[model samples]
Target: MIAIDDILEKIVSKEIEKKEALRFFEELPEKEKSYLVSKLKTHLSNNANSVENNFSEKKERTLKAVTELQLNEEHKGFIDQMAQKLEKNAPKSKENASECQTYFVDQRRTGGLKKALKRLQFHLTYSECDGAYLYDIDGNKYIDIASDNGVNLFGHQPDFIKEAISKRLDKGYPLVGYTEELSQATKLFSELTGHERVLFTQSGTEAVMWAVRIARAATQKKKIVIFEGAYHGLSDTVLAAKDQFGNSIAMGLGMIQEFADELIVLDYGNMEDLSIIEDRADEIAGVLVEPVQSRNPNNQPVEFLKEVRKLTLEKNILLIMDEMITGFRVSCSGVQGLWKIKGDLATYGKIPAGGMPSGMIAGLTKYMNYVDGGTFDYDDESMPSVKKALMAGTHTRNPIKLAATLAILTEIKKRSSTSENKTDESNSCFLQELNEKTRLMCEELNSFFKTKNVPLIIEYFSSLFRFKFLDDPNGVVKELVFVLMRINGVETSPSGNCFLTLAHSDKDIKSIIRVVKKSIDTLMKQNFFYISDSIEEDEIKEDIRSTISTIPDMRNDPEQESIKNDQMEKLRKLIISDLNNFQEKEVTI
Candidate 1:
């Protein structure tokens, strides 16, 4: 037998193909395979400089573009003013929190434009949350639009969910035990999702991981198809991206290349992309879809989803709907329920757990039977029959989580019942009312943007909405927009995705719109959208002098000050040349 170290070395050196390496990896004992995978991940991390060169280049370009744009006279003045305002209002508690965060590894602080955000001291530390509002440490209140990434369906600290969790705690629930709460939660989940069997896990990522495992086990096929631009959690199986050459690549370091090899990512809404699924049907175990991708909420693609469902059924592939962000919040039954399109298997989290960290995989008996070898009764002499797939965790059925989930589902069921009885589809109900409110809010914002020619639009599906740029597809303006929104008393996600909960009143919605409008107005006043073609040379020189004046003092270091002056002179000349070129182009046009 070949040694695991040798196999890993061969994999890292490209001496063995991915498929061949995976085969060897599978033949090893489970513990050895895990060790080998860890070693391989370390190698990938050590060699990430080569793999991540493209990302580094893109980051550099973004930094350069933002720096140059901010150097404009009006923009520089605006930045200076905002910086001063932020400094004055800097929350001491939040500053302490940010300082403490440096001791731990947090993706929230490290991801995106980290350096820029750090320079602005944009870390927000909330002291309390109630309904649709967040109170920062310094007693400043902002309308909460992030919605805890779609987990707070009813809003933060709702009474019913709080009571449920408190009651469960009073009962002294064990970490690992079968309780009546578990049965009730699972039953409610099955009824809501229209699935025969349900399994609980700790998070949405776990639910998705097991869903794929069951699909692969049931069909005896390897590959899973996912759409581009849809986030299905942080599992290695689904962490893939398409390269410029149209080849599948791991989205981040430490993911095995063999896992990327097993994924087929296609365009989300393009009709032509369906043919690839048909062509590769034999190898596909399942097609994973996020009915409404959170990043691009505008592209609902109902027809595309229906066609994908049909193809999966025809091709004997399991349709796995990843409704982590859409479940419960979109409707009582989620996107699958709203569209009346059922999947063979579905994964849910977020609102289903009512803000608790939980995940669920629900599916037909044929597919979910792999979880426990087809349910058997004590009365029967029959034994476990079906081949089982591994699905176990220490806290899979925590009573507190079950209690919270059951409360949320029961509330949803009551509301759904009321909605179903209404003669008119548009009549008032819990979700319907919330969805309608969201629609109106987005319409108002979009209309305002159009009237003002702001080059921004808000798109929504149900209660989920995202801010999209009219032409800034690369997201050059997004960071600045989010910063401005935060400063104007509206808190949103870094990605510009936000949700509306039942707790968000009409007044709260109007306040959100006002903040957005004010932020846009500020940007416009700073000439962020366009640069003037005509400018006097004296005014340009004054702008350069003002820009230099904002720099920190270098009085004690004369040589360094002289070098900085030379660099600033070159930058001023470059800016003038670019402005002249722009004027020439305007004249030619």
Candidate 2:
């Protein structure tokens, strides 16, 4: 087999240009090419971002204080504009104010609200999203990157899984315990992933919890190993070691430090970090990891992952891969499908069960026997329920979401069916195209932005890209995000990273890149080139303050941000509102 380095080294050393290099890659065995592509991309990863001023103490104060303010007219205009773009894949349902009475409180009831409404001319109202699109009360649409946070993969209400769940609804939700739906769902999950069993849970975090408990129970180990700068759901234990600011080292506040003692924070990409606990591997029940850290948009290089697989095996440590984000996005089956990885225990959610709010923990047959089959020699059925009690939650194999998930996965399977080893040409060439497109876009975006002398970084992996909002203390990236939000008919966002969803066509992506290009051009013309490698902190502060000042202050006019104060008063009683709706915030899905 030809190695990836054999190909990339040739490309890097100018033995061949990229086009010829790609042709060489195309002619190689499928596995060889996949390996080579990964190698080639990594070989190009240089620190493309230039350092910018950090947030100042005063700006931090402003952000913290923003919680008390209200949205102004310009802010409202911006919000309305952004809302339209967010509807790219939303279900086309007319949103009548009367229809959403169940979810949002009417803002006309209170005397203060009525008086306030009399005071303002317009209102800005938002609705909760379902999958790929967002709907507004007043006939506006948005492409929903917001809702995919953890569970928007199936493209919403897909017909495949919906029919399966709808049939269940017709059957009266079925009997609750050990039912056929549970069995079939688990069956599909285990079969697809090569796991022996599945324990269904409600959410990704809940599944994370169960995976940890079962690991402790099976190995009788008090400790677990995790990676730094990784988020493993928001469970108390998992949230403990978070790095809030980007030092690569993360620490969490609410988690008890004592738990931190039991948890080993292995610097990502280090296998020796595992050796520190080598003698303690048996004392370690499992190692939990995100195939690719969702927070950092950077991939776990091939070597790091290969080492992880090796160390876990060498130390006899059970591998618990947390696939909540990477499950359906990276490959049709999952990230493990992309790599030759099989975990002893794995967690699934995000696109499985279609898009319905669902989760499950899967384990290999040998390791899962304790949680399955009979306990006390079949004399007690109580043990099975113990697992059930931990796993079950307001379960919705929702017909609509499940249907969407099925469609999404089926398409993924179809796209990925071609194995490099097989003689069949029906391979995941389409996805490879998408991956190539992403790489090109990342490279082009980086080069274009750099040419403008903008010291920003746009990093992409698979279909997702994280735009490193330049180190500009003036919040240029935030401004660009706001511009994307405000642009008509373009629902690009600075959040949820970026999406290369099924609904997003080549044209839609081109529009994004176009806007990004324009924005970079504008920023380059305006951004001051640094005088030397050193930046002027005072100038950064002044720019930030002055830029923020230009936005009309919304603090004095709460009623104007939404419906009139009258409507807002009524709405306030029902809906939770954000005080800092204009503030730049980063969200992970």
Candidate 3:
């Protein structure tokens, strides 16, 4: 019998292309070939990236060999499937890129980015996306849990959005000025968000940047209070970070420290932070917050939100809600509506534009008019015209974006069971249902963690889901879980934030949990969790055994064993925890 290693070696060394190597290896019986492929995958899993780099020169030859062979359809399918999987799993792929590789490779070459990707153990390079799935450069499919950082909430290329774009195209691409589409879009947004008016921008970041600018202008105060772990935008004022000693500082070098100093970073959901607001009331222009912070979505405290509103009101400070993720995501009226507290100003993006590249600042006329070209037409509010903030962009109200937004919001409101004339509680609609589904899934996963004694927990806040490893204070475990999920065909953010849309069916939800469990199993078999110096190897194994003993061997169980069995027990516990968490949370919700 020829060794599989020798065949792989020849392919790697470029002595033969992958097609030739596959033919040589196929001399073995079908069963043996399957076994050999599995073995080869296990051996090359960690080294996939390195192998690609070494064989960069042979890539075209191997690709051409596959095309040159006039194999039967079934044979071609098998080879294609495996080849795509290998390519998707490969660590590097710049040579065959269709788009500019800088988007994927520029940061990847840096030591920090490389190390970060390595720790996660997955390198994603996408070519196209449709619906709720993505097709990578290698043609491997993935269930997109990340949802383009929450922008693709309705999934990719929905029929409504496509139709909207098509209709707009027929109108001759009105890119010059305000079209009927732009007017309709802004009107729809104002109606949905209950904001008196809005100023459109290109992205969520831009929206938040404008929100801060308006707040400072209206209040005539330089200091802006923000919560820790809250992502407002990339603007200089909001790009500041807090140090270990709790001092506010700039995140990157180019950012001016003097401007960053004006940002008062406070702890989210903490009363102490509220007290600081009271102390600095005179100096504060506004308190910017993410009702459900992206980094820790599940940690939103209702009382805290109400408190923020009360304090801001009592102190005469502007309250700016950074609703980039929560706008139209949590509800049509957003977090403020759900929680029954309103912000003086709010920045919106993500699903607001129907998954298009758009953003806007929604607020009362008093603040919004400042950006409406220094015009203050409101009855009671007349500030100095000199205090007005300038806000404009070339694509601010692009007709195509306006058309897409109008279509998306119209659809979302309909799906939410909300009508143009009625003002029903939005929490009773589609958005709530998605959040319920997500919450139940988290509960199921957490139960499995407890059963297996793994120090991990899945958290659900609204429609956002994130997994946490309690012991991983630095978040490496969370990052690894993201890579593992991708390996199992589910892609999400490194923050462990998985955004769900109305498009995700019950089956897709089940698949997400199943793949996540399988990823956990893979990590266990590879002993990836043992990276912690504090945990002993023996205890980990014993914990795995005791937790999964209730189920059949995880590696072979028809229902539980989705992957290999080398560390089957750990994964078995993980899967059951996931399943049970869903079931239990379903009952509770």
Candidate 4:
């Protein structure tokens, strides 16, 4: 017999399973069982509060570090230099920069590093995009590794997609109503995803939001289970994270705290988390998964996904595969096809419309019936039967979008037919060739990093790859690397993520590797990897402001010239002192 105190301690420490603890409680006398239940509730409540407090403390520390890094002199100077170079190379982009700065609120372009970039008045205004390249207004070309955030599976403005859009425009480009294009596109998507029903939305976020609603209506359950670090769009219901105690916490402000009440956040790729779903099976409406998280592509939990599929089926809960990033990029059928694990419902965007904005929700008919009222025959006077859920959008099935989608699906079908049995090693088909090229590029880059002993590594899942730091304690080195890459004429996602398109060539791949090598070497020479811990934040900020004011373009203000001169003199003294310190260190060595 286990002592009550022992069981309570193990439960608090998570050493014993909840089920085991319950079994032990069941064996106790009635009075003891009641006492244990009360104690257990209290312990769990205190544990939750402790977890929340820890998260708050860690968040505070991170914000402080970010503030300090932002004020670092070297970081500011590098960004200013990068901005000046970009402005010189792309004069027209500079001329038109205000149009975007004044009207557009693009967080992706200016979020975390906004203050530095904004002060420098930096922006990238594209004039045209062709195969494997983006041309700025001033005619400077950059290899398009960003690929419009993975929407351009075949690169920018592919001829096939362009032709499809042109054909639709010539046909008057109906803004509303169904067409044969919609029917064919739906049929193709249904066949590709192996889902019986298909519904279109204007964006991936809408698709996910509706999928959750449909699941709730169909299952009559309120709770949704999503994994940590998995992005399922910006919907209020799905934008949440698991605190240390497994309680739901909204990821951002403006989200109602109660919106996360029915959400159960779980640890991605953890087998033990499956038991939690089982424990709360009766209340769960669905399990939403992103097979490869766009932010953290290294996590490809195949076996765990298989187990989720099995568990959801056994428990009669819906499984929603959010393939907004992985869909049509990894394979013709997305992760479900690649991993051979099926979800009851799947959401797709990005590549599905071939660069056109569209979203699709495909699922088994039983659950999808909630979206529409199931099939009804007009001649038989049969009315819609099943319960309905609200799902409507102005651009849900735009004719032009459907035409482009049909064209893309047709192309994918042709490529997939030939590549069905081919592995990543085979270059027999276009998709396989692209995948192989990406794999080889990543392998070569990883090998170079290893040989150079650079504290950076690349992780990829198919054509999607991201740069990760091995030791960036302050988390500022990655941002520096991104700026360096841009200065070297390579564009990447703000998070240092890259998506290789089918349009990228062997030469382009080599150029990318060269740019990465150059960027890393520059960072190493500047000693960016070894940030000094002793520098005071106020001193750093003052030094950077002084340096920035000394730049030739910033000399327009005559009144501040005297102050600038004094700051420059101080900066000169500091530089000489640094050199003297370096000399002393060398003599000591």
> Highest TM-score: which candidate?
1
Task: Give the alpha carbon lDDT tens digit for every residue of 1-589 in model 2.
Answer: 2234444444443333334544564466433432343333222222112232322222322111010012346444544443454433222321333345558685332211111121121222446444355555545665543335535444445455566667656666432444455544555556556677767666778888888877777677777778765677767665433111111111233345566556765567765565655756767778888778776666466677767778778876788888877775665446676776767888878766565666668877656655554233457545442232123355534334344444545555555564454522223345566567667777887777555555456766666666664333122233444344434334444233565555555665666677777655543333322323222332433333333234332222345545233432332222111112211221000
Model 1 pairs in collision: none
Instruction: Give stretches of model 1 more than 4 Å off.
Output: 1-70, 114-117, 420-429, 473-476, 531-589
lDDT score of model 1?
Answer: 0.71
TM-score of every candidate: 0.77, 0.62, 0.70, 0.76
Candidate topping lDDT: 1
1-589 per-residue lDDT for model 3 (tens digits): 1344344434332334444554565465433343343333323331232224332343322111111122346533443454465454643543444244546564323211222233233345788888778888666688888887888777898999999988988987656667887777777778778888888899888888888888888888888988866788778878765532234666554667787778887778778668778977998999999988887776678898899899999998999988888777778888888888889999888787776788888888888877854454577777456445777788887888888888987887677664333454552366777778878887877666554445566666778776654432223344445655766788776445678777788988899889878766654554444322222322333343344444332221245324433333344345335334433432100
What TM-score should be assigned to candidate 3? 0.70
User: In angstroms, how far off is 431's CA in candidate 3?
Assistant: 1.6
Candidate number with the higher TM-score (1 or 2): 1
Task: Output the lDDT of residue 449, model 2.
Answer: 56
Off by over 4 Å in 3: 1-122, 244-246, 373-387, 417-424, 473-480, 530-589
lDDT of 3 at 172: 70
lDDT of candidate model 2 versus the reference? 0.51
True-structure lDDT of candidate 4: 0.71
Instruction: Give per-residue lDDT, candidate 4, residue 430.
Output: 57
| Model 4 TM-score (2 dp) | 0.76
